[model samples]
Target: MASPSNYSSAPVSEFLLICFPNYQSWQHWLYLPLSLLFLLAMGANATLLITIRLEASLHEPMYYLLSILSLLDMVLCLTVIPKVLAIFWFDLRAISFFACFLQMYIMDCFLPMESCTFMIMAYDRYVAICHPLRYPSIITNQFVAKTSVFIVIRNAFLPAPIPILSVWLCYCGKNVIENCICANLSVSRLSCDNFTLNRIYQFVAGWTLLGSDFVLIFISYIFILRAVLKFKAERAAVKALSTCGSHFILILFFSTILLVVVLTNVARKKVPMDILILLNVLHHLIPPASNPIVYGVRTKEIKQGIQKLLRRGM
Candidate 1:
């Protein structure tokens, strides 16, 4: 570890976020679309949360979990996108080192928490479908409340070291970050101090959080499939699979885009930096944008609840 004097000696005070360094002319035009997406994400998620909270009919364990998901989606979008839009719209790229790490920590913690939340939801669906009789005991209100706390604490503290350790590193090099968001490696690479620990911890912590979540989610689906197949009739299997369809589709998009971002990041030398960065940014936005539309709007129960709420409004 570097000494305190080593960190204090650095002259840099803030980081300049160079968003879309490649696109010179039309990057400003990106403001409207990105802003629109952010508004839509916030609106959709906020509406879902309100609908879930106010309506007595949605006071079930599943809706509670869906509410948690919506809250996370709204948080993830709010945490990252506003700063990005600032960069695009007003050229307010200068963010304090303190703010940078704060952003890093929030994004790091919440993104993984969302991933874990998806895994938790998968298990919830599995129990609800595969073992309906035991669903009550398996996933009670108490369980969801306790598990929500665990998810936040586990994800927040597990990756806390990544940014905490990062702040200690001496950043005497260029203060310009290549990416829009305060991404871990993007900011870390600017440090003059030894960053091997940061890199190693990132790899280990990332796989531990993301890898384990993906593995368990996959296992949940496997069990779901097995349970559905053992129904002793084709129609039953279809019905079972159909019940999981919305969740499956949502998780599929979430995992696929994330996997693509990871792969492209690993093979980044062969790809355009803009594309890799776009994937990174979109990974934050797309799932949140789709959540309320897919889960709240298309979901029959949520849809009916919304219509009921609307009718009551009229």
Candidate 2:
């Protein structure tokens, strides 16, 4: 038999990923709760989507945009959760090349799309609250449909180049990703080949899309604030603000999580990598999990609709 030292020193395969630093100490304590959250998020998000689609009361532009947001959250949860649960429950951490790429692709794609949706929702609020008289004409059904189509087209096309450029850069032979799931940065960092262009592309793409969307959202809200100030009634302004509150909170949380991960990940030291990774996963997973319930349970109309649906079903 081979010596114990020799066996202990065996080289790890390039693609055999052991994500956690203390893999041996890994337990399934978080798995059950995470799995439950995953199901809850998916169900709530999907139910919201179905509610908006089926309800004639929710046929307006605001509701249409909300429906789209619900769908985006549902997609985001679906893309990340199954793999996460699988990794925890079954110890199935190794993902193939194509699957990893696809996961990363979906993540990058949806993130920006969701940002766009938030921006559009901001504009909707601007029209509704800031320009109530003109809102009906400006946010017409046809225009809303067109905006929805534009969001879809932009989302599908925008992140296409990131994946292509990413895959083209040589990953050396070392394919072990450090995170629980394949992220663009984690995957790119494994490459032994020249990735200056790849890194530049990722930074530029991330900053450009994320920055632009955030700026637009801020600007829209600025005008909204000015308009709300003009309203003499304090309750009127509060009501208007409440309409956009959940989306704004969700956007702030998501963007902050993203900025923290992106800024920390590329730092010279690797000390913060594990923490950053955990935060990154939590950001992506939790919003999708909590958003629907947050918006649904908190909003009286949605709560009533859900109650009605459940009652009718029974």
For TM-score, the strongest prediction is 1
The sequence of per-residue lDDT tens digits that candidate 1 reaches over residues 110-129 is 88998888899999989987
TM-score of each: 0.94, 0.89
Question: Tens digit of lDDT per residue, candidate 2, span 39-66?
Answer: 8788888888877776667677777777
Candidate lDDT values, in order: 0.86, 0.75
lDDT, residue 230, candidate 1: 88
Question: How many residue-pair clashes does candidate 1 contain?
Answer: 0
Best by lDDT: 1
